[model samples]
Target: MNAEFVAVFVGSSIRFAAPLMLASTGELISERAGVLNMSVEGMMLSGAFLGAAGAWATGNAALGLAIGMLVVLPIALLQAFLSVTLRANQIVTGIGINILALGATTLAYRELFGERSSAVIPGLARWSPPGLGAIPVIGEPVFHQVWLVYLGLAILLATSLVMRRTALGVALHAVGAAPRSVDQSGLSVTRLRYGAVLFSGVMSGAAGCFISIGDIHTFTEGMTGGAGYLAIAAIIFGNWKIGRTVGACLLFGAASALQFQLPLIGVHVPTALLVMLPYLLALIAVAGLIGRQTAPLALTQPFRR
Candidate 1:
């Protein structure tokens, strides 16, 4: 391929991966804290709908993004209440929430934009680092991106540091591995788990917004598709490590970009197959094809103090 094509491909990969990166970052933290937050799909869909609607109403993408994140708090709280407080089955609750979010968002979209479905929504502005954007041929195409991509990268770095080098990180790890010990040490397991879930919700909100506003600059019913589940799959594929998970997300992003890229080079591959690539990798990862996985001991187990 030409240099320009390669540059565009790389940029597209990063753009597509941004949402996965954001969602997986939070989901990793939540899983590490022993909550298998399955409601991520629902949260993302809700955020996509809300962000689109808000931007349409207020004519401000940033404000819409804020509204989306803020609105998901109640949903996250409900997930925490059900899984952490009521000790409901995590998988079941997550699936139910996904179904509910899908229906609710679809209904809301139809009711709110039935006639104006084709209206243009404001999108987040593109940005690049001061030095990077000034580089040679490969600069603009590869570096210029929605601001959320940079924000996601920053959050990933901060999260990695916090997970590896602090008291709170230790406590979070311990809570997932040995909640009883965390309880014995006078830490509040419930609080940590709740916070983790809430963080996941907010990140999922950003991820959904990345799709609807950051990339497409429009909203479509169920536009998120299965990106949320793919984030979970990325976690599993990475063996629950932060860096590996990010790499998995990028790999998936490249696979997604290939759906469009290959066709341009006269390499006609099926779009459906490219879309399924990430999930296929996820299944392989789950089936222990890559290596043995070491999950937190108390993952998905209700902490009974």
Candidate 2:
């Protein structure tokens, strides 16, 4: 590949992978807590729309992020309640949440911004750090990302540290793998699950915000498309680990970047085929699900008292 192509590829991967890393990592946390969230797609789209709209209205990226987080937090809380406290069917409730968020956001958008032939939405500005761009090869595209891209790397590292080496990590693990045993030990399983769900929501909101502020900078119908679903898939592929999830994100990123550049690469592939790579890979990966890995013992089971 040409030097410029490599730079663009890496840059696009970083941009595409950043959101996946963030969202997938969030899903990892929730799944580790034994609560599967089906609403990530809806949450992402809603967050993106709200974040973009907020930025447009106030012209402040930070405020838009706050709004996006706020939009998804409640949904996370509900998941915690239904799955952790109420002991509802995790899969069904999760899917329900996705539907609710999708409908709610779409309707809200229509009410707030009347439907027209085309809608104009402004998003956050990109920031390329100085000096870093001067590095050979990977500097330009990699370093010239938004502030959130940098923050995402930090968050991923910190999360890994917490999961790998920390007291809270152990407690969270206990709550997921064996809520009854944890409860007998005098810990509140519901509370821990609630915290995990909320944190996941916050991170997902951040992911959605990145899509609005980083890539499109404008809200469209189904702005997040299927990113939330992809996040869930990434978590499954990563087997609930922060580091592995990063790999999954990168894989999907490459697929996504390829879809957009197949023509430039002098290929005459079918458009539909190119667009399906990421999802197809996800199907293959998930289908190859190997030996039974241990999930949170209390997974999808509500904890009472």
Candidate 3:
């Protein structure tokens, strides 16, 4: 492909990956802290619905984003309560929550915007670094993006630092590996795990908002689709490491972008196949095709103390 085509492809990849990057960052931390956090998909869907609804209602995308993130706290708390406090089956609880969120969002969308389905929702503005947007052929297409893309990168950097270079990071890692030891060290395993899951929820909320108010500027029932699951797949593909996880997200994003790009290039690959590429890679990762996975010792185990 030509330079401009390549630049557009690169830009589309980043845009598609932005939400995955946001959600996976939090999911990585949550998984590291030993909570399976299956409800990420549900949390994302809820956020997307709430964010879009709020933006449409108030004509303010920022407030909508805030509402989306804030609203997910309770859902995250519910996930934490079930997985941590009540020690419920993490996978089942997460799947159930996902189903519930799907139904609830679909119904709510119908009730709130049934008559005005075409109403334009305010979307977040695109931005580029001071000089990045001024470059020649690759400038705008490659650099201009929703502000959330930059924010997600910042959060990813901060999370990596916190995960690698701080006492809290050590505690989080320790809690997942050996909760008994964490408790012995006078730390509350329950508290750490809960906090991690809550953080994951907030990130998922932002990710959902990115889809509804940042990129699409609109919402539809179940708009999150399977992005949350894709985020989890990204974590597995990256072997639970932050840097590798980002790479995985970008890879999946490129696969998504190809669904549009290939058609333009007169490569009429099945759209379904392009859409399935990420999940297919996810399955390969889970099947141990890429490499051996080293998960946290107590990833889904409940802590009692």
Candidate 4:
């Protein structure tokens, strides 16, 4: 690829990666808190729908984003309550939440929109950098992205800073690594996990917002498809750090972006095969268990009282 191609490639790569990165990092946070919130797919789909609906209703994309974020909180709290305070099986509860979200979003769409599966909402505007958008190699792509892309980057950076530098971060790690010990010190393991899961929920909501409002500018039934699951895979591939997860998401995103380019490049893979690239890569990655990034000791294991 030439310079323009390279810029477009990278720009598209980041745009595609942003949603997954947000969701993956959110999953990483939730999982790290010793809670297995597996409803990411459902949450994302729900977010996608609500975000689009919110925009359509309010005519403001940012308001739509807030609506999506609000939508996930109750679900996250319920999951945390069941799995953490009650000491339920984290996996089962998470999966249950997933089912609930899927059903709820679909039903809402049918009821409100009269069974139409998808529609484009009022999307956020995009802006290219002033005076730089015309640069031969870098114009029109990276410079012309929506605000959510920059927000994704900021979130990633902030998450990293918190992970490495804050006492709250240390406490979260403690809860994940040894909740019993955290509880021994009277630090409220329940609170930490609750906060972590809620944070994940908000981030996932933002991800959904990006998909419907920023990337696709529309919400389609089952549009998220399996991207939430893919986000989890990315977290594994990235070894649980925000930056690493972004990198992994970008890698997968590039593969996704390549789909449109394939025919142009004269590589006519089967359509199904083209679509399967990201998931296939995920499977291949998990097969080797490369580097074996370990989760916290208590991850996915509910803590009682």
Candidate 5:
């Protein structure tokens, strides 16, 4: 392949992976804190709808992004209350939330934009690093992207540091590993879990906004297209480590990018298979085909104080 092709492929890969990185990073934290947040899909879809609507109504992509993230908080709160406070079945609650989000967004979109469904929504601005944008041949295509991509990277770095090097991180780890111990030591298990789930919601919302405004500037009925599940898969494939999870997201992104890239090279693969690659890989990872998988001991286990 030529340099142009390589640049396009790499850029597309990054674009596809950005949302996964954001969502999975948040999910990782929630899982680490003993809550399995399966409702990330719903949270992301809600964010996409609200973000697009907010931008379209106010004519400010930035404001729309903020609104999108904020709107998902109530949903996140519900998720936390169900799983952490009421001690409900985490998986069942998550599935219910996802169904609710899908139906609500579909109805809301039709009501708000019925005749103007195809109208052009405002999109987030693009930016590139000072030096990187100036590189030859591959510079613009590979480095220039929606500003959210850079912001997401920064957030990922900060998350890594906080999880690995902070007292708060230690507490989070302890809560996931042994909630009873954390409670005995004066830390509130309910509080930690609630915070983790909320954080996951916020991140998932941003991820959705990235798709609706940052990337496509449009909101389809289900724009996320199972990316939330892909994020969960990335977490599983990464074996719950930050570095590995990031790698898995990139790998999945590349797999997705190939669906388009292969056509350029005269390589004909089934479109359905390409679309299914990430989920299939995730299934393999979950099935222990890769190796022995070990999740947090307290994951999905409700704590009672």
Candidate 6:
């Protein structure tokens, strides 16, 4: 409504979008490498749990963040091994991993926290770019974000450059679209897919850590709450491109912010609709923009050689 409100809204939108942006970047790469990693949700959950636990135990959010990212590698490896080596059904494997992560995280939380659920954990520090923080009304409110947000943006830019302008990027793209050709060319499709899945796991872990530590400064059972799926939907909505996918994440974040803003502005919108808006838009975008087209030619297909 007002300038101040608008700034807050915009800032909140960015915060909400950061995780999806991070996860989507990783997913894009994994999919580009011909591995349809379905377990991003589970990976994110594991990261959140591990990151939070590490932070609480060490009293250092940075250490927690590192631990979270490190711990998710095994899960990612499992996904890659199943989808890449065994040629398991990607969707089933991903869903199964998600279920397992949810149960495990819940049980672990109960066991670790016990009655100390209300205790506080150290959160990531917040910082704003020097010049950007100086603006009058909109600057601080919008730019003073957790440092991880900045880190994520940097990673996004680096990913964009790598995806658009690098030999390895070409290899990744080739692996997804023409794995047989890649294999024939002496590249190991298996290795490429494994690397991509591992990268996705690391990014998912970072994203999850952002939620549990950077944003909430705490952990709760099932904290990811479908955000992982949202990231996948974001990839579909973005048509697998980095720039468009980032935009899609921001759009979803704005939709999420509206749930709170609408009430404040005296706009009588249904809560359910506001919450469902992002998913609905993603579905529509996918349907309208992706009809009849297909993903990478070799996506989910294991290399025979």
Per-model CA lDDT versus the true structure: 0.91, 0.79, 0.93, 0.82, 0.94, 0.90
lDDT of 5 by residue, 148-223 (tens): 9999999999999999999999999999999999999998998999999999999999999999999999899988
lDDT of 4 by residue, 176-250 (tens): 999999999989988899998888888888888889887788777777888888898887787766777777898
Give the better candidate number (3 or 4) by lDDT. Answer: 3
Q: What is the C-alpha RMSD of each candidate to the true structure, in Å?
A: 1.1, 1.9, 0.9, 1.7, 1.0, 1.4
Whose lDDT is higher: candidate 2's or candidate 4's? 4
Across residues 137-174, which tens digit of lDDT does each residue of candidate 2 receive?
77877678877888888888898899879988888887
At residue 24, what lDDT does model 5 achieve? 95
Off by over 4 Å in 3: none
* TM-score of every candidate: 0.98, 0.93, 0.98, 0.94, 0.98, 0.97
Q: Is candidate 3 or candidate 5 better by lDDT?
A: 5
Estimate the lDDT of model 6.
0.90
RMSD in Å for model 5: 1.0
Candidate 5 residue runs with Cα over 4 Å from true position? none
* Between candidates 2 and 6, the lDDT winner: 6
Where does candidate 6 clash, by residue pair? none
Rate residue 173 of model 1 by lDDT: 91
Q: List runs of model 1 lying over 4 Å from the truth.
A: none
Better of 5 and 6 by lDDT: 5
For this target, which candidate reaches the highest lDDT against the unseen true structure? 5
